[model samples]
Target chain A: MLKELDPLLHSQLRLGVMSLLMSLESADFTFLKEKTNSTAGNLSVQIDKLSEAGYIEVIKSFRDKKPLTTCKITKKGIKAFEQYVEVLKQYIK
Target chain B: MNDEKNLTPQESLEVITSMIRQAKGNMKKSSFYFLLWGWTIVLANLCVFILIKFTTITNPFLVFGLTIPAAIISVVYGIRQGKQITAPTMLDNINRWQWTGFGFTCFIFAFFGQRIGWQINPVIITMCAAPTFLTGIMLRFKPLILGGIVFWVMGILSFLAPVSWQFLLASFAVTFGYLVPGYMLKKTEA
Candidate 1:
């Protein structure tokens, strides 16, 4: 029997954000917005959801006197993403 | 990027794969550093060679003072480029540390140059090989890997040659090791 997918990673924008973070050490807010093709409002909401779930770490700092927000996948998020992929493979099989 | 829309397993996998690919960034901008350092080193090497061979210069090694400005330019440009970067890849971090290690080692060598008889040229050439080779491996770019090998060979030859000849060999090494591969890297991106 296949396990249930993590609900937090089931949404399109959240999953995209997670996937992108997995490949990088960290990424800033603008990068996520451009890559995911999501509006800042939508990306911000999804990022907050991921941060609240402990699936990602959000780092807010200043760059050149401007506010900068960076995000990186958490350890728990990696496990969840891996498990999601495993279940996904099973469904395809 | 709809927040409310749920993705099927297949679509989820697709999104993951695509995003990962997108995050695997191109190192095209990095070519600038290689080219900058390459020309700087080359010019210094030739200048030293000329001064030693013909001119009555008390300290031909002073030609290396050129590196001070090159180092400054590199730091300023690097900081500006770093600010613009949104996605910072693991490879970028590794590359930065690798070169930083190289810089520290060179500094240590320079500090002890008088004590060590200033025979650090051959060893410096050898040191250049490591980062160049590893960077090529990381980028999977064969030209740079070959360039690294060329540096190794020139480094060994420098050890065997006379002190005056060492500068000439170093110039050749930088040409193959940094300049050639750097230009190729830029062209590949274009």
Candidate 2:
């Protein structure tokens, strides 16, 4: 049977962000922005969506007297990502 | 980067692979520690050899005081680099803890140095091998792995040689085990 693709992870920018965070322990907002090549507004919105879904944890703090935001994938996010990849493999097959 | 655009399975796979590659992060900066400690140890060993062999100095071990400044430099550099690191990997944590363990072991040996007598050089060289070799394995750099083996061999040879020649052997151990591989790692990064 074919599995349903994760709508939340199907979009380009969010998927890119998730992919980046999957391998890293945690990543700065600037790193995500640079890697995804997304505008700040769009990246913030997507990050907020992921945070709301509890797929990623958003940490906001101060670094060197400036605002610093870092993001890490949650356990739920890892499970989801793994399932998504498994489903992807089926599609490829 | 289009937020609304859906990706095909193949495209998704590509994104995952590419991002993982990007997250691999260059470990080349680690070569700094290898090179720093390598040169420091080499110089300290040479100084001890020269002072004991030629100079009238009663306490040749004073040369080890150089490590105090090296430790300070390592700490300051480490903290500054830590602040700059946006993404720390699991391997980074492993490498850090491995060296921290090694540092503690060295202190233990120093505290017992008088009890151990002249055999301390061989024991220290043997101690240096574990972290150096394991780090090389973790970094997947062949030269470092080989360097670790060299340390082990030298440590054993130092035990066999006369006590007076042990410092020279120790110097050779760091030269091959740390400095040579460190330079190779730096060049590879460059």
Candidate 3:
């Protein structure tokens, strides 16, 4: 029997954000927006959702007197992503 | 990028691969640090070689003082580049620490290698190989890996050569280990 996909990481934007975060040490809001080709409003909402799920950590700090939001994948997020990929591979096979 | 109800496994795999590729793409820009140090060290090595061979100067090592300016330039350039980066990736962290450690090793060698009566050339070249080799492995760049190997081999050989010829060997070592790979990195950026 096939396992269910990770609901938090199954959607388009959230998955993109998680995948990007997985590869990086930490990424800020602007970088994520640029890479995902996402608008700030939509990206903020998805980031919030992921943050709420405890799949990622969001840190807000000031850089050069400007606010910066940096996102990094949590350990929970890494486990989720790995399981998601394992299930994905099964379906692909 | 549009929101969808459910993504197929293939689409999910594609997303992961595509985003990873995009992240890696950001690292394509050349830092030019290698090129700067390559030329500076090459010049210093040759200057020392020439002074010892031709001039009546008692201290040929004075020419190495030129590296002060080189170090300043590297610091300024590094700060400028750091400001432009939006985020640090894993590879970036690794590369930064690798070079930092290498820099510390060089500093130690510069200050103590002479006091211990150790030949500085072989030690310098051998210590320099660590960062270059690690960087090549991380970036999957073959030229740098080979260059690192060249440095190691030449560094060992430097011990066997005559003292005067050791300077020439140092020159050759940096030319291949740094200059060649430095230019190759620039070419990849282009």
lDDT of 1 by residue, B57-142 (tens): 99999888788888889889888888887887888888988887898898789778888898988999999998999999989999
Docking quality tier of candidate 2? medium
In candidate 2, which residue pairs clash?
Answer: none
TM-score of chain B of each: 0.93, 0.89, 0.90
Which model scores highest in lDDT?
A: 1
Among residues 3 or more apart in sequence or in different chains, the pairs in candidate 1 whose N, CA or C atoms overlap within 3 Å are: none
Residue A80 lDDT, candidate 3, scale 0-100: 90
* DockQ rank order: 1, 2, 3
Better of 2 and 3 by TM-score: 2
Q: lDDT, candidate 2, residue B74?
A: 79
Better of 1 and 3 by TM-score: 1
Q: In model 2, what lDDT does residue A75 have?
A: 100
Model 3: DockQ against the native? 0.72
Which of the two candidates, 2 or 3, achieves a greater DockQ against the reference? Answer: 2
To one decimal place, how large is model 3's interface RMSD in Å?
1.4
Candidate 2 Cα errors over 4 Å, as ranges: none
lDDT (10s digit) by residue, model 1, range A1-93? 877888888889999999999889889999899999999999999999999999999999999899999999999999988888888888888
